[model samples]
Target: MSASVERWLTLEGLSNVRDVGGLPLRGGGTTRGGVLLRSESLHFCTPGDVEHLVDVFGLKLVLDLRTRREIERDGPTAVARAGVETVALTFIPEDGRELPETDGVDPLVHIYLGYLRNRPDNVVAAVRRLAAVDAGPALVHCAAGKDRTGTLVALVLDAVGVERDAVVADYALSGEQIEAMFRRWTTASGEPMPADLTPHIPRAAAMAEVLATLDAEHGTDGAGGAAGWLLAHGLDEADLEHLRKRLTESS
Candidate 1:
C-alpha cells in the first residue's frame, strides 16, 4: 500500500480521515493524490478542520453518501470556510429511508449492515456521481465514514488499478480514528451503539469478505470487483475502458 503514514495522521475532531494517493497499484505507479479524498462524516467537524480542508487541501466538493435519516438526526456539519459545497449524494434515494429499524443496535455496525441490505445499488451510483462531478479535492463521507464511504472508496481505488490488499489497508486506516470516537459514544453501560457509529474491526472485516468473494467469483485481474460492479450496473466493456481512461492512469 502507498499511503503516507505521516499525512494520514491529520484530525478534525471528526475521526476516520484519509488520502488515496499513495497506494500500490498493478503497475509501477500509484493512485494519484488531489483526485479523491475520503473521510468520516463531517457532522461534528471543527472550523479549524474545515479550514485545513479548504485552505490547506483546497477541497472543492463534499459528497455525502449518508441515508436521509442519518442527516436528520445529526444535521448538516458546519465547516466554516464559506465556498466549499455539500451535495446530497446519499446512496438510498427511497423517498423515505429509515434507520436500521433496530431499537438498540450498535449504530456503527448496524447502519452499514442495513446499507448493505437496503441500498446496495447506491454503491455504484455514488461512484458515478463522484466521477461525473469532476470536483477536485473532493471529499466523500458517510456518517462515521466507514461503510458507505469505505465501499465508495473501494470502487474508486479498484477502478484506478489499486490492489485488493492496498484497498483494504486504506479502509482499515479509519479504525484508529473511528474506534476512539465509538468508545466515547458508547457509555460505561454500553448502550447499544449509536447506529451511525462504525464497529471498525468487524465492519472492515465484513467489507473485506464481500470483496474477497467478488475476487473469487470474478478473477481479481479481470472484470470483477469494481469492473464487475460497473458491468452489473449495465455498463459495457467499452464504457469501462473509457471510464478507466477518464478517471485512472493509462496502462
Candidate 2:
C-alpha cells in the first residue's frame, strides 16, 4: 500500500536501519522523508556509514533506547563519536522490575505493554526529544531496532496520523531482516543470540494489537489519541505540534 514506502537503508555495517517515512496518512499526504529514521545499534557503523549519516543524511540527533548495561557492553556508537547529539533514554527499567504476568497474551506483546505501563515517563521524554530535533534528521535505535525502537516509532507515526496498517507493516518489516540482523549481532558481539528469545520476532498482528490497546486505553480522538497519551504523560502541546509538522507531508 502507498507504494510500499522506502523502508530500508543499506549501510555497510547496519542491517536494520530504515527511514520511517513516505507512508500514507489517514485523510491524505505521506510522511516526510529524512526527518525520522529507526535503526539497530550504531555501535559498529563504518567510517563511510558515519559520513553517510552526517553529511548525506544530515543526522543531527540519535535517540538511543538501550539500557546502561547494553551500551557499556556494546561500546560507543559511531554517530556519537562523529559529534551528533545522542541521548540515552532507557525504555525498560534497569532496576529489575518484572513485567506483570498476563495469561494468553503473546510474550512480546506483554513486554511491549509493560514498556508503556512501566516507563511512560521515559517514553514521553523520547518523543519530546524527537519533536525538538530541528537542526536535522533524528535516528532512534535500540539493540535490534525491533522492540523498543518499534514501540516508540509506532507511537510517533500514529500520533502523526499514519494509518494503523501502515504502521503495523513498518513494524513487521523488521521481521524480514531478522536473520541478517542476527548475523550482524553475532559477528559484532561474538556471541550467539539467546535461544529462548528467538521466537519473539516482530509480527504485524502484535503491533496491530498494541495500537488497538492504546486506542482502548486512550480515546481514539480528542485528548485520548496518541498525541493526548503523550500530553497526559508530560509532553507539551508545542512539542506535539512540532512532531506532527515535522513528520507529515501535506496532501
Candidate 3:
C-alpha cells in the first residue's frame, strides 16, 4: 500500500465521504486506495479538507458527476493546484428521474441502478474517458456521496473484476457509514430524528435490488463483468491494461 492510500482510506468526513479502495475482488485482487475514490458532493468541503486531499493525498483526477444546476448550486471544488485534472460527466437520465428523488441517499441509488440498465452509454462514456486520458486516483462523486457516484463506482468495480455481490456490499456500506454519522448528535427539543436527516435504508436496499437485476441479466463471466463493460465502451486490450495498471493490486 502507498502513503497516499493511507491519507484517504476510510475517511469519514462530517458530510458523506469515503475511499472506495481496499475491497477484495472476486479473484484475488483488492482496489488500491487513492487510485480511486467515491464521495458525496464537494460543494461543502472546508479549506482543511481540500488541503488534505491536495497536499496529503495528491489526487490527479476528479470525476464530478453532478448536474450543471447542481454545480451552480454547490460551487466547484477548490482544488486549483497543478497536476489535478477534473472531468465533468453528466449521467444519462432514464426512468424520467433527473437523479435521486428522495433525499435518502439509498433510494436515490435506485435511480442509478435502473439508469445503467438501459443506458450503458453513460457508463461507456466514463470508460472512454479512462481510455483517452490517464487520470490516476480518480474520484467520482455526486450529491450526498451516493447515486450517480454509486452507479459509476459499481460499474468501475465490475470493470475491475470485482464480484457483483461484493459491489453491492460496498454500496450498502455507504448507507451504514452515513447513517452512523447522522446518529451521532441530537437536537435540544429531543425530537425524533427527521427522516430527511437520517440515513436512507430503502435507498440502499433499492441499490442492492438493482445489482441483483444486473446479475440476472449477466453472470460472473469476466466477459460480461469487467471485460464486457470495457469492450462495450470500445476499450481495446491496451486500454484495459492501462486501467488495470492504475488499480491497487497488493497487500
Best by lDDT: 2
Q: After superposition, which runs of candidate 2 have C-alpha atoms over 4 Å from their true positions?
A: 1-5, 133-135, 189-198, 222-224
Worst lDDT run of 10 residues, candidate 2, spans 219-228
The lDDT of model 1 is 0.65
lDDT of 1 by residue, 1-251 (tens): 43447537376475567777767777656666666678777865778887888888888878888767887787767752366777776765557757645576555445544554566556655555556535566788887676778777776677657877777777777676765667545653486666664335535565566566556655455634666755666555665554454455533
The per-model lDDT (C-alpha) reads 0.65, 0.85, 0.61
TM-score of each: 0.74, 0.92, 0.73
Highest TM-score among the candidates is held by which one?
A: 2
Q: What does candidate 2 score on TM?
A: 0.92
How do these models rank on TM-score, best leading? Answer: 2, 1, 3
For model 3, the run of ten residues with the poorest summed lDDT: 3-12
The Cα RMSD in angstroms, rounded to one decimal, for candidate 2 relative to the true structure is 2.3
Candidate 2: tens digits of C-alpha lDDT, residues 1-251: 23443567779988888898898888799999989889988987999999999999999999999999999987888889889999999988999877777899977778888888888999998998888846479999998999999999999998888987888988888877788878777776799876654475798888888877778877554322666678779999899888988999888
Tens digits of lDDT, candidate 3, 162-213: 7666677666666654654445323423656657844454255665666555
Candidate 3, residue 111: how far the Cα is off, in Å: 1.9
User: Higher-TM-score candidate among 1 and 2?
Assistant: 2
